[model samples]
Target: MRALQQCLTLAWRSLVQVRHNPWELGDYSIQPILFLVLFLFVFGGAVAGSTEDYLSFILPGVIVMNLVFVTVYVGHGLNSDLTKGVFDRLRALPIPRWAPLAGRILADMVKQVLCILLLLGVGFLLGFRMEAPWWGLPVMIVLLLAFALSFSWVMVLVGVMSRDPEHVQLFGFTALFPVTFVSNAFVPLETLPSWLQTLVALNPVTMLVDSCRGLLSGGPVLGPALGALVWAAIITAIFAPLSVRALNRRLMGQGGAA
Candidate 1:
């Protein structure tokens, strides 16, 4: 109970900080809308038959992509807090070591919700609609949020390990771009070579995307959804404690070797 309260307090402060910094929202809000519009309008017919078809195919991928990129910035936040000694100050408090990380993750989740709404609004304007029932919508959103949280653990690790936040941005793009695009983002897995297809089929990103599309289209979803959940659980189990330990070690004046 105490840890949860501390987390909420820290999360609220982090949100206020975000409100004061308009640039963060702009980057998350504007960029996804721009990319979705440009790709659906300009390249839809060339690649995916029509705008409507492309929207159905691409909207799921777009949402996943947005979440993936947004979570990457968690690393930047971590790096900034460390360099500015905010983390060091937090360490002096009686709060749990995981409290601040939990708080930041929650704040990022709220930002993600806003981002998804903006993207969905833009997508609707572009003629995107899910054929599934109303109940399915919330389920899809929950699954996507879970996937985002699972992925954020890795970002937290990177942020804890980074000595310089500036270079973290470059490393984020370099690492995430390949994992994202190489999945079932743009093209159908059937279209890829056997080896590439195998990789995409095994990619957790692809499973999440597939599950989301299934929920949206009212298609069968037993496999992809289950697979995504299992992967998320495994990732959380492995990284959450490691992250806590890393933060504690860092606060003790240990290097960022973790």
Candidate 2:
């Protein structure tokens, strides 16, 4: 109970900081919107059939693309706080050491929600329409939240192991851009060579974006949705505890150094 209270308090503080700095969050929310418009308006007609057809296909890609990239920020923020000894001060309290990390995750997850909503709003304006009923919207949100939690777990571990926030950002882009662009996010896998098509189809990111689109398009829901959920579970299972262990080791190592 005490730990939960501490976590909630710290989480609120982190969220308040985000509220104060709206522009930074806005950048994350807006970049994908511009990318979606630019790509669909400029190249989509020549690449895909029509602008509307491209919008339907690309909206899901854009949502997951934003999510995959923005999550790196969570890890970088964690790294920054740890490097600056912010966690040191928090550890001085009687609360569970995990509370701060948990709080950070919670706050960042909220940011993910905001980013998704903004992208969705922009998508709607750009002529994307969902074929699913009203119930599907909430379900899609839930799935995305699960995905954000899972992906952020790995990033938090990366942040814990990182010495420089800039390097984390660079590494994230280097790793993420290929995984995102290579998949069926902005294009079809069938258009690729046999080997590239196989990889794009198997890419967990491709599965996620496809699953989200499936949900919205009223396509076969159970199979792809379950696959994405399973992937999220496996990732969370592996990385969540790993992140915890990494955080503990870092904190203890700092204590020894002091």
Candidate 3:
């Protein structure tokens, strides 16, 4: 209970930073607008035959990609805090070791909600609609955020092991770009080569994208949604412990050799 409270306090601290420095939201602000507009206009006619059709097809996928991309911020922020000796100072506090990490992650989740809303607003203007029931839209938003939360441990592991925040961000793009773009985010998997179709079918991003597509635009739901949840479970089960161990290693004064 005490640890949860401490975590919330630190989470509030993370949110407070936005009030002081609003530019921290630049990525959340511009990236969504650019991706939504650019993709809908640039590829819509070729891919889905019309902007309206492509808007429906790509909005949920773009939201998933947006949330996935923001998870890298966890690593970047953690790496920056480490460099500033912030964790070293936090060590003196009588809080649980995981509190600070949990705090930042939770705060990031809140920021993600804002980004998703902003994108949804832009998408609405572009003719996006929720074909699913109104309740299902909020449910989809919650599930998507939970899915994104499962990615936090992976970022925490990368952040703890990286030499610096820039490296963290660099590694983030290299690893995330291929998985996200290569999947069914921007284009239909059926249109891809046979081998790429198989690979896209196996991609967790594809599962999430499909799940989001179903929930928001009305399609097959159960299979991809369950698959995405399983992927989330697998990722968190593997990385959460690894991230905790990583923090322990740092607490014991080991360098970022891992």
Which of the numbered candidates is closest to the native, going by highest lDDT? Answer: 3
Provide the RMSD of all predictions against the true structure, rounded to 1 decimal: 2.3, 1.5, 2.1
* Model 1 lDDT, residue 85, Cα: 86
Give the TM-scores of the predictions, in the order they appear: 0.94, 0.95, 0.95
Ranking by lDDT: 3, 2, 1
Better of 2 and 3 by TM-score: 3
lDDT by residue (122-178, candidate 2, tens digit) is 888877888888788778888888888899998898899988898788877888889
Record all residue pairs in model 3 with backbone atoms less than 3 Å apart, i.e. clashing. none
For model 2, the stretches where C-alpha displacement exceeds 4 angstroms are none
Best by TM-score: 3
lDDT per residue (tens digit) for residues 2-44 in model 3: 8899999999998898888788798777887898899999999
- Residue 209: error of model 3 in Å? 0.9
Residue 254 in model 3: lDDT: 42
Model 2 residue 242 lDDT score: 95
Q: Which pairs clash in the backbone of model 1? A: none
Against the unseen true structure, what C-alpha lDDT does each candidate score?
0.84, 0.84, 0.87
Looking at candidate 1, the ten consecutive residues that score lowest on lDDT are 249-258
Error of 3 at 198 (Å): 1.1
True-vs-predicted CA distance for residue 44, candidate 3, Å: 0.5
Which of the predicted structures, 1 or 3, would earn the higher lDDT when compared with the native?
Answer: 3
